[model samples]
Target: MDESWASTIAQVVSQEYPAAMHHVQHGPGHADPRELHPAFWGSYDWHSCVHMLCSAVKLHGRDSDLGLSALLDQRLTPYNIAAEADYLREHPLYERPYGWAWAMQLVKVCRDTRWEDALAPLEAQLEHNIAAWLRTQQWPVRHGVHSNSALALLLIFDASPRMRPLVERTALDWFGAERAYPHEWEVSGHDFVSNGLAEAALMRRVLPESEFDAWLQDFFAPEAYTFYTAPIQVNDPEDGQQAHLIGLMLTRAWLLREIGKPDGTQQLIDAAAAHLTGTNFMATHWLITYALLAEDALGN
Candidate 1:
């Protein structure tokens, strides 16, 4: 939220435009990510790059910082973003729900910014793709990982009221029946999001307050959810796989705030803050976006 954090995020999202490109080149001619995805070819992957760009839009909208403004102007141009849309059109299910969700969030956050028009092409593409996916996909990917449907739908639910009805219907059908979550079985080593927590967070947005309270009680089974009371620790921050747990702490903090678990939110935020020092590229490449999410949700 400060100039220092802005600088760090700018550095991470822009530093390696062509490095670590995670593209599944399906019968490709040229495998270069910069030419392929000129707008979102950074921050390791498409979704991370998108959410970080979302952060840029939000920061610029808030403070009108000249650096962030310049970044937005450079990357969020109609020419570059339409190229991103063109790429997505070629690969319809490229990022599927996760990256699509962040793409929508990016546009949603850019509503009042100057970049809104630039993102519209991609936004329209995602609208058609995600809507079709929501209607046809019968199952939710209820994992604490990139493919998780609940968290992505949760992001979509917040990104627009136009998509809310579809998101709510699909979310209820997929996750409404979930109960008796085995809290201990949650959070695989490389997971950054908690499947159980993301489901609850989505349901909270869809269900009424009293219904959600009852659903929460049934989902956790009286007192089985103390696992998240403390922040998850990453034993090896340098390991790319283990580094995901750093994001887990930050995401859990915001979702905790969403589900009215204030007692644990501070603990998670405090524990996750130490890793945002810009020292570890494994953590810094994408964790600041989630840290900003926690900071906003906690009103800090």
Candidate 2:
């Protein structure tokens, strides 16, 4: 809840364009990132751009600053949103679940119906993608990165209430029976989400409180939670992949707090604070959003 931290993040979200970029070329004619994604061509990558937009919108809502509101309005104009929708129409699978989830989060955070109306086409396409993905996917993605199905579903659950039943059903089908995940194999050096913890977090949101508590007890042994209480070591904060451990810490903090575990919360907070000191361009570009998310989870 630091105003300065929020302002710093807002500055990055608003002004960092044509940023230290990275993308995958699906085909030719994919020239500039800005041309490919009019509304989300900043903050280094597509998903980050989308979430940073969400962050800015949410921050403005909390802070109620005219300048911040105008900044978001300028960037999320009807024309820009329509162009983003067009891009999604042409390339539905461009960022898949990650970018799609953040796009939905963007819609969820917008207070104006104009922004929602502008993003309708993109939202519809994302919904279509979710349904199609559910029907075709026989198994859930267990990775700790953007490809994780549970993480995407969690975002979708917040963004689209109509999608909730389907998402919950799919989650129960995919992870309901899972238990005793191998925690020793974690800290994968490049993990933004803890696969095991992310699934637990999603289930906590979808299931009844008592049911979720029982499920957590069954799914994760006491030692598993204890194992994650310690901070993950990042040998190279400058390396984008290794820097993901910072996100892992912040995410774990939020997830743990959400699930009513307080002991691990401070540990994760301290860990995230320590990691923040060593942040480089790789982590600085996107980690602030995760840190804010953690703060929100902690009710700071």
Candidate 3:
């Protein structure tokens, strides 16, 4: 990663606080965002905060900058993480699949066991939720955002190993027989994730390499893959929902890289570069993490 990008990520994760906090008063007392999630109260919302933290930690691992390390330590205190865990206990459904996935990813990135211990409460809550969801969810959610079960399972499998069997079972049960996905029904104005691509990414993790390749061949027609290689247009980057197209670009790059299909790599890279050319506050606050994730997937 470039030094400038790393610096920007550190700055945003550390200083971009106090906007886009989704706090709802559940009872007589109203809690502030910071009060509810002391460690993860920045970067627009809880899920973003968690993923941004994950990005910062990941970048620090690659760069080994003292300043970045200090910033992480300053913000990721045991007290603050405990407060975050407590908030999850209070509002179990808050950012259910999205935040829960990122929280587990955050745990995966934290090198310190102390940080892991601090995050135990939140981890426990998310694990419980995942198990419950697997048992009850009869159908997979196809949306690209928070509700996408495949996306959540992929994250869980990445971050939490114990949940692998359940995630694999649930994913295969929901998506094993899927074929000829409808590519035309995509790029919903607010979609940040490609449901079809996400499912392929998740299947890659659960199935053997040969099986996944066969499954991929059966699941997406060549035209559908070609359609995804072209980036979706973002009519208005300033519009928070429309800005999600940038995320879709990043995620597409990630999926392409993970699938290792050389045909689409350059197109995915080009699309990602185009979407990343400009920035808006709404997108800047959270989109870089997805960009970094794509780069990671591509071994950059």
> For candidate 3, what is the TM-score?
0.91
Per-residue alpha-carbon lDDT of candidate 1 for residues 90-161, written as tens digits (9 for 90 to 100) = 788888888999999999999976788888998899988898887788788877888999889999999988
Candidate 3, 115-230: lDDT as tens digits = 56666666777788778767887898888787888888888998999789999999889999999888789877788888988899899999999999999999888888778778
lDDT, residue 112, model 2: 68
RMSD to the native, candidate 3? 2.3
lDDT of 1: 0.82
* Alpha-carbon deviation at 55 in model 3, angstroms: 0.3
Query: What ranges in model 1 sit over 4 Å off?
Result: 26-30
Which of candidates 1 and 3 is the stronger one according to lDDT?
A: 1
Cα-based TM-score, every candidate: 0.94, 0.90, 0.91
Pick by lDDT: which candidate is best? Answer: 1
Query: What is candidate 3's CA lDDT for residue 288?
Result: 73
lDDT of 3 at 186: 88
- Residue-wise lDDT of candidate 2 within 1-300, one digit each (tens)? 446556555555554454644445668765676776678776678788788778777777777753566667677887888888777777657777888888888888874644667777777878887787788889888888989888888888878987899999998998888877777777676888888887888898888889988889888878887877788877888888988988888888877776777576677767767544232557766776777677777762
